[model samples]
Target: MAQIGLFSSAFFTLLAIIFCFIFRRQAWIALLCSSLLTLGLFMPVSFGVLLVGTTITYFLGNKSQNSSKIGVGIGILLGALVSYKLREIWMDSRSLSLDDFWNEDKPWQIIGLSFFVFNAISYLMDIKRGYIKSTDSIFKLAAYLLYFPTLYAGPLHRFNYLNEQFDQAKITKKSFNNGMRLILWGLFKNFVVAQRLNQLQIELRQSDIGGWWTLLIGFIFFFYLYFSFSSFVDFFQGVSEIFNVRLKDNFHKRVYLSRNRHEFWRGWHITLNEWFRDYFFYWQMKFKFWRDKPYILLLLTYLLIGIWHGITVKFFIWGFLNACWILLEKRWKIPERMEKNNSYKFLEIGYHLLICSLLALVFIFPSLEGLFIRIGKPNFLPMDVFLFQKRNVVIILAMCFMVDQYHRWSKDLRMDAYFESLPSWKRRLLYLPLILSIIFFGVFMKGMDNYYLKF
Candidate 1:
């Protein structure tokens, strides 16, 4: 059976998009109606909490002129986020269990809280800075808060941008076609590439996968993570475009094509990074001590990013390790001449492949102890077994690489430009196989939850 969460997200998002087209003149009302339907379907409690919070913040933030009051508003939102992140610990302390959370009788359960809280903080901050005019319209505020496309996984849409797009959106035939193209490509990546790698991931975790196999598993794991995340980004971006709301681009070609760790950090899950930069990193720069020690700021930013995934030791180290690499780069800048040298570039790619592969182990294993134990137990795979165990996975991996390389070589970072450049007939012809492929490979498969939603 298809995963209900995935199926419903696609179904309701399509419903909302159609609503936008039909009620183009009354965009806010259309969005408000569809948004409520979405919340009712997927997250009824969450919708109530979000509405309460939005109502509170709208009045409090708009009227508050003092810095301390604004700080209080921001603090409350951050507190809610921190509380949700540490809820598992809270549940343990309270002797609560899965049943307690899953039981419909429970009044409080949290999912997708962080994304909403982050947006809430941004909204308050923007209001304080006079970036967005404070509004009393509950419908519009609710629509912005409850915008379904980004409620789960997000490029973290800005409130002002969303408000502007509500009325000013221009959804042309060309843009509509491009949006369709993105959604189809995203489905293929999610259904084919990510799903195939997930099977390998299950096996790797279960078997005594060690030594070189550990690194192989790690790389595959990262690939799955990338495909899963990028797929949603494509889907969300496509949906946003249809509404003429351009959600921030979270992934760019630089993610895979970048030669250095720094570049990868800058490009991958870009809006999240940008949020950290704006809210956390820049805030730290105001302090004289952290301003002098830039690396400390960098470390804190990455560590925050890691723990935001979940309050685990594994995530802490993952953030710390990335910070260390970034700091090391800052201390020893690569020579411009060496950066361009083919030999150096080749070695750099290999270096990233190795380091990233190993670092991804942090994500695969839950704790430091498990990761160390797995590393210590070296059970190298037979070449034939490794290669032949999942021939379809190998084919998909190769095809993904070829597609990425084709885009890179063509100088179209995103294939949108290239695809749009095609003749209308050619574009329609291409869309046919893509649509069929999705039906054949995607709709029937057991749907996977978005990996990031756990955060």
Candidate 2:
């Protein structure tokens, strides 16, 4: 039954692609309409909310003056977002069991509401700021808001960027090939690597292991989060590419290899960080008071970012600690001072990586006490058991590390150009192993839900 369902889905998807290709000149319209239908089918309530929100934003942008309209639009979007988050908090508080405390399956919860609301608010702000003209056409506004590739977990692309791309959208042979490559790469990362890491993490947490062994779980979790989120972005970006629409890049290739918190954030979730910087951080800094006290503004920005993830105490602490680390880095000028010394540079990289991985424990464990108990207890599991259980995971991690190193070395050139420079036989050989790994080791039946999807 599952295979039949899967086959039917693939068949319809293929038909949709063919239809889009046939009407290539009006590809955006076809994509937008199909995306609306799909979203409506799976998440009807979310679809309704998005439709009404987009309509309200459209009218506000069109009918009112730039200044007051922007404020009103933002207020409406923020009000909706805040209300939804508050409801989530209230529901969590009322849960009868610990297992239900952080339940993701609440009937009232709206998936992707946070992302779309942020995008809609940005759209309004950009109009007032003259970054892009307000569209008179509601369909264009709908297209921007309902674009499926970014509708769920987004890169939070701007209206101007997407609008400009739509003006010249056309899929080429090269783009098609590149899209396939990205899709295959994403599948390998999500299914073969991230899923395995998630499984290993669950196993370690359930075990009696403690001390340094528990610390390894945190590191595993950081990688799992990275791969899972990045893989989703990659997959959807590839889908957009096939339609000749280029979405913004979310993760930089060397994010994990970052030497400082600023560098890490600049690379990690590139779009979201930039959105906060532009719409929230820089906007606040324009005022004299905030401009004079930049550190406070910075702290507030990070805190808001934390609260953006969840309206919870743990997320707040996560944001506060991250803000402190960045401030410390700025105070010492760590990146600048350490850049000239190779030894110091290596140490800085390791320090930042370790700190980030450790900080990730704030999100992984429900409480600080649980986290401390896992990390502080002296009892240790047998080395053989640990090695035996995680042998596959270690091998996968090594493979990912090697690929990342190659990307680091080739950072000067575009990945597509580098791949094109390779001989056809070598390229085919490279694809062979990636495809084989995804087929044989991929966890398809479980762990498909991405970590970032909840937000």
Candidate 3:
């Protein structure tokens, strides 16, 4: 339950710098130290699940080629997931009807168990497929599972990628500069942009607002999610880059340019979606029945995605609806060509934004009854009402939009390369605004955890 606050981020950043210097040639030692430090920050209960899972996987990985052992590993992993996530349902279905069975105090559930388990499972699968060479070093395996940067919220890295990177990591001038830029940029987005929206979200939750306001709030929540989650990913990537690990870029550069749900999914929460796609979707596709009816795999992929968030009804609904939406998009074969025109592109963007905002309502409302109530009843309220009331939030939203647009534009121009091409003094000067932004706007924003940390 302990969230990664601002102070923790600073501590980790400083520690990463120190680790880079001290364990320059031994990244495994740095990772081990970081894992321990991160464990110390959170409840011991949280680390319990991680420790058990990592231990089990490390052992299972040695004999991963054995089908029975692989089954046992998968079973143990799935059992842990079901016992922890569906504890209430499991209890409810019991004949004894022990209402307090789940109430007994245990170690706090792991904060990033969902993501970490995926990493472990992927590692085992890789080993099973002979994709990962057997290594006797527990530290290397531990580092893969317990890597602190992505521990709180991952664009979960594959074990093979991380392992490969560990062997190749080295501190370099370019990585240092780029990492600094990403860190400052991430700080600004999280603290300045997302924090403001978070305040609005809190207010909206407390208020009795409904109708159009719900949709408005949904849009705010949607953007807030992007800002918060992407910020953490950015920071994580930057930290990893500093260590020369260079984790995969989780978010696509042209996420906003997505014209369809499929493209959107490819960009957003990318690592999680990719994990489901690669493991579940692809595996299911091999079955004769599912091969023709690919939508079944699609639906199940999203369902698991939902369940991965938690066993909540909302998460289930969110996953299922999105699954359906994507299937419909595929069935219709939505034209990528129509989005070529400037006007059409803007229209498409607006349409997608509206759809995303409305769909996001599923996350807010637990049941269909309440969701229906909001949709069935529309207050023909002017946009001015909400805009005027939450003027500060509107301004922040505008700032976010502008920043995102700039990001999109910069990517098209290969801004990173351009920055690197600059002279040394000019490159240092570029850091000034980023540093100032983090210092000024981000200074007062403390203890505001990223939204995905809860998942």
Q: Pick the candidate with the highest TM-score.
A: 2
Indicate the residue-level lDDT of 115 in model 1: 75
Candidates sorted by lDDT, best first: 2, 1, 3
Cα lDDT tens digits, model 1, 170-199, are 567767776767777777778767777777
The list of candidate 3 runs beyond 4 A from truth reads 1-4, 19-21, 87-107, 337-343, 376-391, 412-418, 421-433, 443-446
Per-residue lDDT of 155 in model 2: 84
- Using TM-score as the measure, what is the rank order of every candidate, best first? 2, 1, 3
Query: lDDT by residue for model 3 over 1-455, one digit each (tens)?
Result: 22344556567667766786788887667766866685766546667768878888878777557467876887798788766777545554684232243222434446677777788888777777777765687778888888877776586888878878878776788877777666666777777788777777656655656677678767878878888888788776776677677766677766755767877887888788888877778867888999998877789889988877668677888889888888888777764555445567777777788888888888766466887776666554444445654766555866676576657546643334446666879877766755665566552534544767646
What C-alpha lDDT values do all the predictions have?
0.72, 0.76, 0.71
The window of 10 residues in a row where model 3 has the poorest summed lDDT is: 96-105
| Model 2 lDDT per residue over 91-203, tens place | 66686443353343444546578778988988998888777778989998888888767876588988878877776666688777776776677777888888888878877
Q: How many backbone clashes does candidate 1 have?
A: 0
Q: What is the RMSD, in Å, between candidate 1 and the native fold over all Cα?
A: 3.2
Q: Give me the runs in candidate 2 sitting further than 4 Å from their true place.
A: 1-16, 96-106, 379-388, 409-417
Which of the two candidates, 1 or 3, achieves a greater TM-score against the reference?
1
